[model samples]
Target chain A: MDLTLDRIRLAYPDGDGVLVAVDDVTLTVPSGTTTALLGPSGAGKSSLLAVAGAPLDAPDDAAGAPRAARGPRRRARRAADRAAALRRERIGIVFQQPQLVASLTVLEQLELMSHLRGRPAASRRAHALALLDAVGVADRADRRPEHLSGGQRQRVAIARALMNDPQVLLVDEPTSALDHERGVQVVELVVRLARELDAAALLVTHDEATLDPVAARVHLADGRLVEAPAAV
Target chain B: MFLALRDLRHARGRFALMITVVALITFLVAFLAALTAGLGRASTSAVTELPVDRLAFAPPAEGASPTFTESEVTPHQQEAWADVPGVGAAEPLGVATVRASGESTAAVTAFGVRPGSGLVPGTGDGGADVSAGTVVLSRGAADALGADVGDQVGAGPLDLTVAAVADAEADFAHTPVVWVSLDDWQAVGARGDAAAGDAQDGPTATVVALRFGDDPPTADALAATDAELGTVTATPREARSAISSFTAENLSLTLMQVFLLAISALVVGAFFTVWTIQRAGDVAVLRALGASTRYLLRDAIGQAGVVLGVGVGLGTALAAGAGLLAARVMPVVVDVSTTLVPAVVLVALGGLGAVLAVTRVARVDPHAALAAR
Candidate 1:
């Protein structure tokens, strides 16, 4: 397994005490595979994916299963800076919305990933172009987000997530705004990209119809994972 | 500044409006600064540009600053100052405004200096001949009276010949100057005491010009001399306040410039504050994408710096052109102090406002981008 979660727990401040968002959920997704977390609203599917992406710091001594200790490099990078470097170097996140920067073009969106890691974006132009080509949005590469359709923007976002060739891809509802057919197409596209890039993908979605292309499925409810009888 | 440049290009209209506001403020500040300096020169050039390092004025009332208007230094006071150690040359300078009738009549300040005092610009170099009954006219005074060298001018009960026109120009109380002998100034009945031509103990001139030869008197020694002579002394710069018009005019103009500077800073701050708040969602997305807080702040401030540089550069150029044109009809100086100094100050203050506004980037949570919009 390229990505592992050992009883990951996450909580947020409620009115007085704490409201646990994810509790004692241990899961692993091997490389070149996609795992779909299927649950309804408030099921903590997004929270688990967020933890795997390392956006929210995993609580120490969480559920008597403390997170893996940081190595020398991670220890030296300092809290937020460390997380940011982790995301920039190893984890790729796809938000619920396309969330394309209004000022950037489709091609520049991929180029920005390289820029964030303190590399000259121009140095990776060929790779960025190849990613866009792989995602089948090469024709719309020069267009701005407003000029692209909803499905096209999602594809461009997928291409951007793979720009740095991250090891773990965490996608949250890639087709939330799409219709049935487009939703299936986007999920299939994510599976293909994850396999081709040989990256472990954890996708959070409540749409059961889109799970056919996903390699495995897990059920979550009220911040805890349920044992699915037919673990497909 | 990659994102910054793109954003600026994408939102040209908003940034253009901000740049215009900054430019207009810079124009107003630079122009006012030039006018203030010019007006100051017109009001006190004659006194400030004197050849001596210091001027001794009759002491004012208790707890009051010295004034050239009310000061009256007598011959006895002048003699006392001349006898002081390190006193190189103490010359009596009488300042009085009178009407001069030459080819035309104009109000002129008669500066009374003894022969070979070199208090006038053209005296030592033979550019002007300052004998009895002959006056040396500053270029401004010559132009005002339409009198050239060897021309005769009637200066308040004294018929004086313009022996030579001085190379430089000086003004006092906004009137052109004409150098006259000490006797001629006394003959005009503009002395402190009104004796109507009878021999009387009266003020020789308004102030005495004091020049240090090799070793100037120490501050303590000068203070002691002031106490002994019942007088007060000031450097040429400090004496500028003694001119009644200069003090009021300069203070008002300087205050206006200061206010404009403050307004520019607030305007820049307000503009960037609104811009930052409006784009907070974008900032969150960027953070989630792994952009450091330091990177975003640099991009924002670099954008502001580019705008300020262009706007202030254009505004300063406009002021210089306008000042050149305005100088033809009025007093307006266009120089480095008036233009470049104000521009640098505007950029600094405006940059500070931008820094304050963009610091909010650090507080944006990257997790917010994970939620559904």
Candidate 2:
């Protein structure tokens, strides 16, 4: 498994009590495969995805399950004091709303992935341009996000996620804002790109229409895994 | 600077307004510093320009500080100072303000010095020819009196010759100085002080000017000498306090400048506080993308540096130009102490404010960026 979640639990503060968002949920995604986490609103699908994207040290009160420790930036062998370095070098994220920086152009957005890791932009421009071409937005490389359409922005985001050739991809409701056709197209793009890059991909969403292209489907209900992830 | 520069370009309007505020604050601070120095020079230049190491004043009343107004150094005190070890030159310096008549009449401070005393303006270079009945007017005094060299000027019932118009500026209590011989000075003083019925044949100089040839007197020696001669001795800088209005005015203006500096720091800090809060979302996003706390701080502070550099640089240029123009009609000096020191201080203080505001970047949780917003 390129990614694993071993009985992870997450909670947020409620009015004088704790509200468990994710309860002992374990899941995995093998490399070169796309897995879909399907659930309704408030079912902790996003919460689970966040955990898989960047695992944390289990709290003292959490259920006695083994926690996966992410490594810190400076020391590779030591467990991460934070997930910042892990996210920068190995994990790519596709946020629900594209989340492209307003100041950066589409191409620069992809280049920023390398820049975040202290790589010079000149050293990554060719690869960034190729990623844009693969996502079919090479023509819009110089245009800012404000100038792009919703579909175009999503495409740019997908290209950005693959810029650093990440080992794991965490995408959250990328199609919630699109219509059926554009939504299917984004899903197909993610699935194809995951296979092309040979990376483990987790897609978190409640929409049932976008599940056909996913190679594995995991059912979640009320912050708990309802059934084991069924691979097609 | 990657994201910082882009943010500046994208939010040009907001950043420009911030820069303008910084510029205005810098201008106020720099201009005030120049004015403070200018006023200080105007207040103390007369005493400071005297070519002597120490000034000896007759011991004051029990609790009062030494002052030229109440000081009355006698010939005995002058002779005693000359007898002390390391005392190079001791001379009587009589100071008094009286009216001068040239093409027009004007008020002037008269400085009484003997022949070849070298305390009079232009005497060191043979420029001023001081005679018993001739006076050498400083540049300011000459301008005020409207008198030139060789003109006959009436100085209170005594017609005196203007030996030479010396290019020197010494203003005592806002009055310019005119150098005159000691004989003419006493002759002028006997009539001037005759109203009190204490005008007699005596040494009437206000203070004794001292110059130490080798090692100057230590604080202990100065105090011992003061005790022995029955006089108060102080350096020229210390004597500035003796000018009636100088201490009060200098203290008040210096305090105001200090307050202005503090206010400038607060203004910059407040501005950056708001700016950082507005960009907190961006900061979180960057943090989530693996940017270190150090990187984010560098970006924020780099942005501030750009703003402060341009704003302060421009404001300093404006103040310097204004100071030059104001010098024609006012006592405005444009020097390193007046201009560059203020500029450096403003930038440093403004940077401090910016740092205070942006340090919040370190505390922002990267998890907030992933939260559903």
Candidate 3:
């Protein structure tokens, strides 16, 4: 497995105590494969994605599950360092909304990812252009987010997420805002891009119809992953 | 500043509005500072221009403080000051406000110094003499009375000839000054008319100007001298408040300037506060994308600095141009202290306000961006 979440747990404040968002959730996906997390809203699917992407720090202990023991402060610092490294080296994200900055053009948006990674943007222009071409929005490189349609904007965002050639792609509801046909196309694009780029893709989706193209599907209910269907 | 520059380009109208506010505030601050400096110069130039380092006036009586209008240094007090140890020179200076007439009548403060005192105007190397029965007027006094060199002007009972106009400006009590011999000032002060007092018991001169070399007298020495001679001594700069008009005029103008500066800071703070709050969502998204808190802060402050710089630059330029034009008709100075200093202050203060406002970026949670997950 290229990306793994080893029995991760996450919690948020509820009243006085903490409420579990993801409980003992262990998952793994190999390179060049796509996995779809299917669940209704508030089923801890996004929490699972967040943990896998290292956006949320996993809980310190897993309720007596065998784990490495360390001081709380040391563990927290390690987790923080891991998250930072994950963001810089391994992970890419597609937010549910287009989440495009209003001022940046489509090409500039992708270029910014390279800039943030401390690469000279001019040096990475060809790579950025190629990624945009792969996402089928190379012709609209100069257009601002407002000028692009919803589907085109989503494509631009996907291209942006892959700009750094990340090893793991965490997408949040990429097709939620698209029509049925457009939604299917977006899912297929995610699967194809995952294969072409040799990246492990985690697609979180509420629409079950869009899960057919993904190689593996894991359903989530109330912060717990349901068992995968047995092979026939 | 990638996002900063792009945001400016995208929201030119809002940034332009902010810049205009900054520019106008800077202009007002610079103008007020110039006017304050100009007015202060007009009020205290006479004492400040005195060659001596200190002035000694008669200490006020019970329940009163020392004042140029009320305090007087007698001949005995001047002699005592001159004889004090470490004192270099002590010259009696009689200051009194009186009306002078050439082509027109105007209020003037006549400064009385002895012959060869060098404190008198036009007494330096190769300078023309201002003996008894003759006076030297400052440029302001000359302008006010419309008098020229060799013109005879009536100063109270003494009809004196204006021997020469002094190049140095000296004003007291918000009135232009005329330099005359001590005898002439006494003659003017003793004029038997209602404007001049006939009381012989009063002190001869208003104050004694003092100069000291090595081992200047300590405060205790000065206090002992004050007790013995019945006089009060002060540095020339400190003596400015003794002028009645200077205190009131400077206080009002300085207060207004301070208030304006405070308002400028508050205005910048308020504007940036709203701007930061409006961009909180963007800040959250950026943070979630691994943008450090420091990066976001730099971007926001850079945005603010750009607005402040352009705005303050424009406003300062406008003020300097207007000040130059106004110098001919009004008392306005357009120098670096008057122009550049205020612009720098505006940018610094406005930047401070911006920093305060945009610190909210540090507290924005990257978790909020996860809501879309």
Candidate 4:
């Protein structure tokens, strides 16, 4: 399924005032395509991604402003439950850091996703191994994150996110810790995997150098989405 | 258990340390349980092993409790007990501690009864005649005296022959008992009391052992008889506390065992509480990755179960071995109450502590996993 973030809003309060993190933000990533959310830090890139990936109750409390209603209170609860279920089965997320479980081996990390989805581990072994191979870390399948290099860990994390063949892939600054050359290569790998798997990919990043493989770039200045590049 | 098992293997040193603590606590609890049981046996077996349902004693002064050491039931009190409605059998139980000399000499609690009162250790097995001069010795008494039937032993200047050794084991105040005739007991105790210038005039004994029939008299009837005769009666179990020093000693050991059990649970709670706090971040990541609260709790409890089972199992085995060794030189009874009960309790309470600790997994904010560290 395609991911649609219709005119959603997120705001925080600042000294007797509301600071909008996202304002009427509307965007979409169709199947088999990629959408790159890029901006400077504090531009609400992460907050907007949170709204799309894990829908929560809009903040309307001290130090925060009201968010656009996803629906009624009961409906919103159902929606959040629906969203959680979707995340388990259809959405894949990659945080800025590798964040691979310290105890899980490379292959086990991906298999864990299938296990969470209630799939038999034995049945997913070959698939987990194949995903690791696709990310160029097949030989390191038996090794834990402690022994792997930073780039290798990121590769494993990427493979783990894709283990369930998600419809929407959310990438958050996956190359922030890698060297310039390696960063470019990691983004390229993500782009290639998204296209090969036909997943609607949303890549959040601040590095301009890594935008070569990102098909569409949506910029956020202060919680509001700027128009797509004129190249569109 | 996927995460639980791996976490244990990855952090073997930490888990092993916790397991050792659990093992030692289990060992302490099990060992103390055995000791309490053994002491209880030594203190009250002589009374508990009696065939009667209850023992009747002359009431103490206005507020004092009934005690075997101070109780003295006369022939009149025995006749009153036997005459009570629903009284199946009432036999006088005369008890006295005196030094006896045989192949091996030791202090023995001499039990005095009628020749055919059927209170002797091996009554049906032709134990001892309990006539004027012969006495039946319990296994422990015989063991201490090193005497067989026809062997002679003397008690307080009174000579008697050991008629037979019975398989029963009886003790009072940690001393084995020797069954003798009421006449013989009166002769011996009478001499001692006379020599001490406090001899009683008539036949007197310690207490009257009673057994109730199928249609036993109600409590009201028993109370009326007691009021009329000015006596008190207690079930075998209640009478056990009347044994000198039995209550205080048993209470202390039991209290210690209870404290050990409570301490083990608290220690387990403290350890897991810290463990859970230490891994809160990992828990957040797991929850963020779609692992449900049930899954996390199961994993944690499974980890605790492994720790408790292995630890308690090891500890019980050690305690059993220790009990076997201790039994030879000291009073220690190793049985299910000492081993299995403690092991089960350790696991249950340890699991409870773990549940209290890991429930925090339910409140972990999956959103935190997205925060920049």
Candidate 5:
């Protein structure tokens, strides 16, 4: 499925006013394509990724101001519920750290996504095993996160993200903890899996060296998209 | 309970330690509860098991409390209570702690009542009555004195033969009871000086036992009669407090049991509070994965219930076994109320404590998981 963020904007409260995080950001990533969002630290790359993944509330119609409706209260409860449902149904998020639940094994971690979506674990076993095989860690399916290496853990996390067949896959600095070679290989694997699974992939990273594997790249500065780079 | 079950399996050492703590607390709670019930029974079974509905004692002095030890009822008070409307039968009952001997000597509560009265079990039949020098011993009293029917036993100042043993077992103030006639009791208690003054005024019966029909005496009428006659009337169960030693001993043991229960709850709360804090990161991750607050709460409480159930079950079993063993050597009585009630209470209170602790999961911020914090 294709994901389109039409004029999406986000902001946070500053000392005396509000600071824009994603300024009128309009972007689209069609199925089977990998888009890397790159910028310096504090460039609003994470904010844009967060907005796309439905983790943060959408920006207000007002310019350079945070939407005042996102605070926790009875009035904003319906909006929060809708946002939560969106995340549950159509979004898959991978954090900078593996973020693997330590108690679950590799296979169970993947199965948990299906379980969250209301599928029985027994019925999802074959699919979970298949995803584990696709991620090239099927042999370690029964091992917990503590038993796996950093690269292997990230692979299991990737498999878990795809377990629900989410429409949009959001990657947040997934290679931040890896070496140069390992980071490059992880990025390549994400690109390959995104294409194979026909997912609209958004890769957010500060490491510019890993952008070579992405099909397209976007740059953001000071909460606004500076320019849209050509497709690779 | 997907994550909950996995956590239990993965953190076996930590959960095992928690379960052990719960087990020990449950063991103490169940044992104390059983002991409390057993001791209460040993102290009050004689009065509680009586056929009469109420007992009347002599009224205390101004600003004083009425006690079985200090209260003595006169024949006039007994007659007044007997003549009260709706009072079917009223019998004089005397209770005194005295030394009784057969082959060996032991302290026993001598209960003085009329032979034909319903108060003494197996007395209306061909069973020998307590005449001048005869007494009926309860099975427990017989066991304590190592004496049987046709054996001789000695009370305060008189030697009496054990005519027949009563079938029902009753105890008062942790002492076996020996049933004797009211005349014999008065003879034994009368002082040489008091007996010489007025034959009816020497130490009278300790209390008056009353039986009520379907239409029984009202509490107001009973109080009025007691006020007019200078006496106190109480239902059989309410009269337990009149036994000063039983009341004090029971309160202390019961207070300890209550304290133990409170400590169990606090221990459970503290343990789960730390467990929830340790897993705050995992909770945030689950929240970010679209797990609702309700779902997480159910999972946490269900996990706690599993632990409590297992721990309480094992502890109750151990308590029952220990109670059975203790019954042989002590005044312990192992029954369903003493064992099962405590197990159920421990699990319920432990679960409540756990729920209080795991509610912190609702406050965890999903954004923290994104920060790798």
Candidate 6:
């Protein structure tokens, strides 16, 4: 499935007026491709990615559009419920810090996707183990996130994001805490996983050097998309 | 419960502490309940376990509750109650606490009943042959005076022989009871002036014990009869309040139990509130990952249930054991109402507190998970 952000507009409350984080932006990431959202700090790349993952009451047919469109109270609630279900079943989110539950092991982190969808985690053990093997972290499956290295944790997060075979994978600064070499390797793994899973992956990162493995790139500045140089 | 179970196991120390707190509170409540019931039995068993269904007392001043300490019923009042519809037998019963000397000196409540009145505990079999100078001693009264059947005991102004020591135990106002003839009681009470042809009208007793037929009078009918007879009537159980110490003692203990329950609920709520706040970030992440509000609430409340279950179970067991041991030295009735009821109430109130605390789960913004924290 393709991830389309059609004329998306995201705003937040400022001192007196609204600060538009994503200004009528339209973007698409076709299936089986990695589209890197490159931008500096406060460029609204993370905001746009968040909107794509689960848009907040958006009128346009953005990714995860509002389901209810009539009554304000019920509509907002229904929309949030719909968006959460969308994120659970179809969209896998990978945050900057791995966002792993401290009590869960690396293997259970991936299996959580199945559990969140109300399925038994044991039923998906083989698949979870296979994903860990694919991510080259099978040896560390039973270890908590604190015991794993930064790159390994990021790999685990990526594997977890793919646990449900999501059509859209949204990742935000997954390599911020890693060194230069480890950061490139993590991004490369994300790109490879996207291709293998046929997921429309939108990765948010300010480090343009890690775009070697990503197929397409789009830059955002001042909450508006700009043309980017071709990937290596 | 996937996350909830793991959370509990991961933080066993914290959860254990919480369980201990719940258990201690449950223990206090359960033990207090048992003690309260036991003390209540000691204070009012004689009046409550009476063979008669009701008792009639000289009506108190308007707006005042009846009291055995002040009630004085005459033979005329007993005759009036016997005439009321649905009445079976109305017997005059006099109650007086006095010091008696047998092998030892002890305080005993002297119960005065007419010969063949069938009011004594063992009198169900055509009544004990209690004569004017003889008394039937309850087992408690026997124990206190260290006296046996055929032993002579001095009570009030009369010296009486123990005709028989009744097998049943009865107490009135925390003192053992001794049954005696009504004539002997009146003589010991210095009401013999009437028998001596003095100006006093007649003899009097504390209250009239009224036994009813199978088809008893309704409340309204009883009230009407009471008004006509110039007396107040109450069922034996209801008459317990007339024992001055019972009402105050029961109220104080019950209030303690109620306050402890409230404290346990507040403590559980406060613990859960702080816990939910600490895990607000994790909750946001889960919401973002598609866990519904209802699901999270269920998980958190289930966690509280586990803690309360283990705690209350352990506490009740502890209380039962302690209560049994305490029963050896003091009155402590360990039973279902004292143990299980308090435990269930604790879990319910504690769960309420936890539910209120974890409601913050619904308000946690999923967008917060996007930030570094």
Local distance difference test scores for all models: 0.86, 0.81, 0.81, 0.82, 0.81, 0.86
| Model 3 agreement with the true structure over B1-373: per-residue lDDT tens digits | 8889988999899988888888898888888878877778788888988888789987887866578887777677888899999899999888888989998999999988787888866678657656899998999999999999989999988899998888877788779999888878877752222125555444668899999979788889988988888788888899988888888988998788778778878888899899888888877667666665566778899988888889899989988888888778766668898899888877788888889998877666555666733
* TM-score attained by model 5: 0.92
Which pairs clash in the backbone of model 3? none
Docking class of predicted structure 3: acceptable
Q: Which regions of candidate 1 are displaced past 4 Å?
A: A57-78, A229-232, B199-201
DockQ scores of all models, one per candidate: 0.39, 0.33, 0.30, 0.32, 0.37, 0.44
Model 6 misses residue A162 by how many Å? 1.4
Off by over 4 Å in 3: A16-18, A57-85, A228-232, B62-65, B190-202, B218-220
Clashing pairs for predicted structure model 2, backbone only? A70-A80, A71-A80, A72-A80
What value does the lDDT take at residue B112 in candidate 2?
Answer: 83
Report the number of clashing residue pairs per model: 0, 3, 0, 3, 0, 0
All candidates: TM-score? 0.94, 0.91, 0.91, 0.91, 0.92, 0.93
How well does candidate 1 reproduce the true complex, by DockQ? 0.39
Query: Which candidate should be chosen as best, given DockQ against the real structure?
Result: 6
RMSD of 4: 4.3
The candidate 5 chain B region of ten consecutive residues with least summed lDDT is B188-197
Error (Å) of candidate 6 at residue A201 is: 0.4
Among residues 3 or more apart in sequence or in different chains, the pairs in candidate 5 whose N, CA or C atoms overlap within 3 Å are none
Instruction: Give the candidates in order of DockQ, highest first.
Output: 6, 1, 5, 2, 4, 3
Instruction: Tell me the alpha-carbon RMSD of every candidate.
Output: 4.7, 4.9, 4.9, 4.3, 4.2, 4.0
lDDT of 4 by residue, B1-373 (tens): 8888888888899999999999999999999999998889888898998888889987887888888877888777888788888999899888888889799899999998888888887786665558888888988898998998899989876899988887887998899999888878875553234234455544468889998888788989988888888889999888998887899999899899888888888898888888888888788676666776667788888888888888899999999999989999888899998899988988888888878877766556556776621
Model with the higher lDDT, candidate 1 or 5? 1
> For model 3, what is the error of residue B181's alpha carbon versus the real structure, in angstroms, after optimal superposition?
1.5
How does residue B197 of candidate 6 score in lDDT?
Answer: 41
**Interface RMSD score of each model:** 4.2, 4.2, 4.4, 3.5, 4.5, 4.1
Write candidate 3's Cα lDDT for A1-232 as tens digits.
3778788888787889998888888888889999898888898887887777675543424223354543653555456445655675677888888788888889888887776666666678998899888888899999999999999999998898888888999899999899988888889989999998899999999897877788788888878888753547
- Local lDDT at B227 for model 3: 85
